[model samples]
Target: MLVLITYDVNTEDAAGRRRLRQIAKQCVNYGQRVQNSVFECLLDTAQCRSLQNKLCKLMDPERDSLRFYYLGKKYESKIEHFGCKQTYLPEDPMIL
Candidate 1:
């Protein structure tokens, strides 16, 4: 499945700044960041739930917002992109 995770953390204080960094770090662990606060992650049900759990713990409901869009297994045609960055399938083989 392709999971699009987006978040907004109130960075008006030191604690909020720290929370933002921590959230970004965790997102990087699970996927590629396509935007400042948006990530494209390919994960299974269990993995998605796990990531959600981790994020829930990191965010303050009153001060932060998080969203997850599940694109299921056939997500290719579901997404369209246009910009500088080229899009690639998460399952594509990398020869590096």
Candidate 2:
């Protein structure tokens, strides 16, 4: 499945800034970043749940926000992009 994850972290303090970096780090391990705070990850059910749990624990519910959009296996037809940033296929091979 394709999971679109977005987050908003309050970066008004040092701790918030740290959280933002930590959150971004975690996201990068699982997927590609589409925007400053948005990521597109291709993962199975178990992987998705595990990632979600990790993110939920790192986030400050009172000050941060998180969202996940499950696009299932057929995500090609579901996503449309028209922007300056280059788009990528989640299923394609990634050269690290």
Candidate 3:
């Protein structure tokens, strides 16, 4: 199956980006990160769970912010149902 994962980091600091990248690398060949904080992962149930665990570990306690969304579907599904629903929004402008 293919899974779509989206994540939002609470801050724009270097630490946040570094943590995000570290978590993403865990997926290796099973996933491809399509956006800065979003990743399109292809995996089975076991792989998904492993990825989730790794993501939780990458979070910083001081930040108090970590969020992830996962969407999964069988390989035979239509293309229309796959991919991101919206374009990436800049973190700066959205704050105001």
Which candidate gets the maximum lDDT versus the true structure?
A: 2
| lDDT of residue 19 for candidate 3 | 78
RMSD of each: 1.2, 0.7, 9.9
TM-score of each: 0.94, 0.97, 0.57
Better of 1 and 3 by TM-score: 1
**What are the Cα lDDT values of the candidates?**
0.94, 0.96, 0.60
lDDT of 3 by residue, 19-71 (tens): 76776676444566566655666677898887777777887766735454444
Per-residue error (Å), model 3, residue 10? 3.3
Global Cα lDDT for candidate 3: 0.60
Which candidate, 1 or 3, has the higher lDDT?
Answer: 1
Task: List ranges where model 2 is wrong by over 4 Å.
Answer: none
Sort the candidates on lDDT, descending order. 2, 1, 3
TM-score, candidate 1, is 0.94
Which 10-residue window of candidate 2 scores lowest in summed lDDT?
Answer: 83-92
> What's the number of clashes in each of the models?
0, 0, 0
